[model samples]
Target chain A: MTRAVTIIGLLLTVIIGAGTYWVSHEVERLEKRYAGIQSEILAEQESIHVLQAEWSYLNNPERIERLSQEYLSLAQIDTLQMASIDDLPENADQHLYRLDKFGEAVAFLPVPRTRPGDLMPDEAAEAMIIDAPSVANAGGNQ
Target chain B: MSFMRFSYWLRGDRPELRPEQRERLAIETARNRIFITGAMFFVGFTWISYGLLDASVLRQGNEPAVASGTDTRELKTERADIVDRNGILLATDLPTNSLYADARVVKDPVESADLLLTALPDLDRDTLIRHLSSRKAFVWLRRNLTPEQQYQVNSLGIPGLNFQREERRVYPHGRLFAHTLGFTDIDNNGIAGVEREFDNELRINNGPLQLSLDTRVQYALEEEVQKAMETYSAAGAAGLVMDVYTGEVIGMTSLPDFDPHRPGQAPADARFNRTTLGVYEMGSVFKLFNTAIALETGSANLNSVFDATEPLRIARFSIRDYHAENRWLTVPEILVHSSNIGSARMAMAFGGETQQKYLKKLGMLEKPEIELPEVGGPLLPHPWREINTMTISYGHGIAVTPLQVVNGISTIVNGGIRRPSTIVKQDGAPAGERVFSRKTSDLMRRLMRLVVTDGSGKKAEVAGYFLGGKTGTSEKLVNGRYVKNARMSTFVAAFPMQDPKYVVLVTLDEPKGTKETYGFATAGWVSAPAVGKVVTRIAPLLGIEPANAKAPEIEQALQIELRKGERKLASF
Candidate 1:
């Protein structure tokens, strides 16, 4: 009985020892992974900071103005073209463009300096304006 | 064995026991001791193993996750960023590689120095050679190398040459934001502007400091002001844009300005901040205050008339209007025509004591308390005599900074509330001191609008912005005497006259009249056109949707009864 008890005890000890060793090794691996993730976050944050500074530099008014003048021919928004929402046509279904809306494409696009202070052209980068489906198609679907 | 035998003797065995029994007892005792020792070892191992299991699985992420998550805002750069009102970065700290050398490790100092010189042509050859040849363990070569230069140095693969990480205070927009952001020294110490004012607070490591300045407005103001300076070839020029309600300085420009990155190389004159530091008699812009005071004190109304028929001579000085109406001008006509004789008579209607009290309440008698270290106090007359009052009625004998003038103008137009001007962005409009009555403010707005519609400020009138201002031309005082030809021509304007939003001031020093101006270098010509251009450019950026200035409501609101059935002024 004594020999059997001793053998059982020794077996339990070996099992516990192996389990402890495995669990500790796994913990170390997880710790290393945690450290790796932290460093990755740090590196990404640093890169993002650099990108923000670059964005500010790229969005400089003078630089953008120069680039726009070289590329686009935009005109200044004239005071006559400005209209309030109250001035818009009441029929919402109608595709009615107010003076300000009418002025947007021609005013901010493709015009050189018309007067002394009529300069600042914007970088309206070839916008992707998807058109709506035709009225006939909508009527048929309904 | 001896120790075991002594313990056995201490146990004291019976004499009747046989040899076999004695051996059995000894064996049992040894077995008991072994059992106890094994049990202790097992318990200790169990405790340690349980601790490991609990920590890795159960208590995981308790300590380290807190550390990592909390430090997200602690960025890699040592210095915090500074942004404008729109979150545009005005100033920032960028990482850089500083070149140092491990002098003891260098193989051939001569070859390394030659390679270094080739890579960086600006470095001194003799100094480089001596530094690299030093027997010390470390040596200094240079600091804050650009990325391209760092790459070149790294490619050289020169032994002992190393790069230590550092940071540089970079102003990406250069001279555009020089006087606002200021610049840091080589060690990243704040030297001037907002940087100097918020030095300690910045070092505490928080988010970017957002200033009240709008970058787009600032760019417009600076470019327009710079263009005006170059066009007329003036001595110096300054411009300011302030929010009429909140007293927030949205844009300020003082040319010629210097690049913050190279402040040392810039001339002393370029480094001087003219908008805040330089004080000047703001010409006839003072009439806005004079008219406001007259109406507020009930001394004069819109219909009250004063004589502008001739230049009034008082105490060896002649107060002459630049473009004299040469008639008995009403109060509205006095401001509309910018008549000095009328303004002086109007100030005399209310005494100098009342003028002093009003000016004092407008925050003009002291230095403008702003977020910048470079600010000047107003230069007031010593004795505050009667003659001083007449000249000061039209902006002379008292010199106030451009900042004060803009702030005071905002007070006169913005419901008569005087809020101290600030550079730091505010969450909302703070409380203000009431300097004049609402009725008085409304009347002043009408007079200002009337000035733009049918007076000397016609050049400043945009189509729908309804800009109104006063034309000021003061002979600059030089060596205790006013020079005739050299004049400080200035125009102070407020836009959207019905509900005045912003006040803009443009002043040029000694602007010469070009052929375009027809030999007229007065404020009406030199600075008024710039004000109009600035309003045209900035109005859109500020999101101020233009309204019909000729609307009957606006016209009636801003129209005044100058003479009986005159119909004198145009639409507001």
Candidate 2:
């Protein structure tokens, strides 16, 4: 009985020794991986710094102006052509009827635009609610 | 017990085995085996304990370090970047490696120098060889290597050659922001302009500095002024755009501007910041102040008349109008015709003390209030004499920088409040001290508009903008005398004049007569058209809506009466 207990105790000691060694080796590997990730972060930051400088160089205003002049057909927006929607003449029929400074008639169909940013908070919420019911209707049919 | 057992095992006499003696022998043998087993267990526990103590307390496992390399050093820039109000980059620092020779390790100096010359031809061979041959531990071979050049040198792999990590200040817009952002030295120290103004903060802060200047507006101003300078053949040109209420300088440009990246290669004339550093007699632009001061002091009203029938004679000097009106002129007409005699008489009515006090309040007599080191103070006459005040009334005798004029005009039109002009962006207008009553500013605005409509500044009129301005043509002083042909033509204007929101000033130094100008080099001919062009282009960019110039409200706001309200000033 004494021999059997002694043998069992020796076997357990060997097993614990192997387990401790395996854990220490695993810890070393994880430490190495942590170091690699730290270095990679440093490298990414350096590249980003360089790219920012390059981006500014390419986005030069003088160059962009020249390129626009060469390639683009769009001209600068005139102040007369811009007016807040509220400043536009209120037409009960939602028709375009405008008179310029010369008292000459100019007409164009006023395209109704529904921009999210232009909507008031309450109006935007109402729009979302209306959209949700349509989606629910499709789901119910499916 | 251990010693006694050992002795018994090595007993002095041997014993013959009896029944009890034999039993005793077996028990003794068993007890000895147990003792041996206990000793083995104690030894095993001591070994395990020593191992645990060593691992946890006695000896620490060395942590693997983030390897020492260039990546670690390049993580931070030495100086912060500079950007416009729109977050457009104007000046920035890029990581670069400077070549240095560990001279002690260099084996073949001549060969290495030859190879380095192939890559960097700008470096002097003699100096490089000498640096490489030195016995010292380190010697600088070249500074600020471009990435391509650095790659070439690294590929060469010559012994003792290494790169010391460094940063270089780069202005990618080239000459666009030369006088504003300035440049830095090789050691990355700010040398001038905003770079110099906030050098200490830039070195420590990680975020880019945002200036009040708009890059788009700056480019527009520069391009227009450059074209005008070429067309008029002016010696140089300078201009600025200021927010009337906030005193924030949106765009400013001085012609013959140098590239900030290669400041050393630029000529001295190109390096000079004319807007802030060069002081000049700003000609008739000062009459705007005179009119405002006259109204503010209650010495003159729109209908108050000063005689322009003949040149006003002062001791050893005669002040004459550039265009002789040769008649009695109302106060508004005085500014309209730029009548020197009438302006002098108006100045005398207020006297020298009041003129000095008002100009001081406008910040005209002090150094330019800006964020540039290259700035000059106004050249005021030594004594506050009556003649000095008279000459200054028509923008002569005293000299001031263009920055002062823009700021002063902003003060007059911005509800008669004086705020310091700043190159740093502000979220809102700063609180300013009241210099003149709001009513005086309103009258001044109306009178200035009349100048654009019916006076010498008719060429500056933009149909829908109600542009108002005063044209100034002053003869350049040469050899102690004013030369007639060599003139500095200047026009200072504010747009949508009913409630003036912007002040734009354009000055041409020694502009010659052009064929298109009908052989006239006056401010009305040379600079007024440029001011008009600038306003028309920049107004839309500045988000100002165009209103009909003939609209009833605008017409009423800009209307002024002449000859005691009997007749209104008429526009042709």
Local distance difference test scores for all models = 0.84, 0.83
| Residue pairs in collision within model 1 | A73-A110, A73-A111, A74-A111, B284-B472
Query: By TM-score, who's the top model here?
Result: 1
In model 2, the Cα lDDT at residue B421 comes to 88
Candidate 2 displacement at residue B513 in angstroms: 1.8
**Model 1, B225-328: lDDT tens per residue?**
88988888899999999999888999999989998988999999998888899899887899999999999999998877677778999989898986677877
Give the runs in model 2 whose Cα sits over 4 Å from its true position.
A1-32, A76-142, B1-75, B102-114, B121-139, B478-481, B562-572
Write down the worst ten-residue block by lDDT for model 2 chain B. Answer: B563-572
Model 2 lDDT tens row, A1-142: 9999999999999998999999999989987887787778888987887787788788877789889999999787654555566655577454556777899767755775322113345744764542212444334322
Candidate 2 DockQ vs. native = 0.11
- TM-score for predicted model 1 compared with the true structure: 0.83
True contacts kept of 2: 0.26
Candidate 2, residues B67-166: lDDT per residue as tens digits?
A: 4444333456788888888888888888889999999999999998999898899899998888889877989888888889999999988999999988
* Angstrom error at residue B174, model 2: 1.3
